[model samples]
Target: MNFADISSDIRHNQIIELLLQNNNLSAAKIAAILNISSRSVEKHLAKLKQDKIIIRQGSKKYGT
Candidate 1:
């Protein structure tokens, strides 16, 4: 369950970089930036969360 496994993934790395640039970026925004679907972004985000690599800070609509 080490994050290092997926951390090396291109999409995962890009997501992390985007978050570092602006922590408030939403999944949809990330998706648009990456030219991927929102669902795909959500899936990646969910896995990141499950791995404890990231955390959702507040409400879904207005949270970072």
Candidate 2:
């Protein structure tokens, strides 16, 4: 499959994988690990939340 066809899924998968490895990672950290922008990470995260694929459990400052 071409990258253009699966790029969004790839990003979502990367985020899920990173969260699985360490659920406490911040969006910025995920972005750093994935070498993407934080905004992009946030977008994926929002989508995941809408799909009920992931959940946030704590405060933004010091929660996971």
Write down the TM-score of every candidate. 0.81, 0.85
In TM-score terms, candidate 2 sits at: 0.85
**What does candidate 2's lDDT look like per residue over 17-38, in tens digits?**
9999999899899999989999
lDDT values of the candidates? Answer: 0.88, 0.90
For model 1, the run of ten residues with the poorest summed lDDT: 1-10
Query: How many clashes in each structure?
Result: 0, 0
- Model 1 scores a C-alpha lDDT of 0.88
C-alpha lDDT of candidate 2 relative to the true structure: 0.90
Model 1 Cα shift for residue 48 (angstroms): 0.3
| Per-residue alpha-carbon lDDT of candidate 1 for residues 1-64, written as tens digits (9 for 90 to 100) | 5676555477888998999999999888999999999998988898889999999988978888
Model 2 worst lDDT window (10 residues): 55-64
Best by TM-score: 2
- In model 1, the clashing pairs are none
TM-score attained by model 1: 0.81
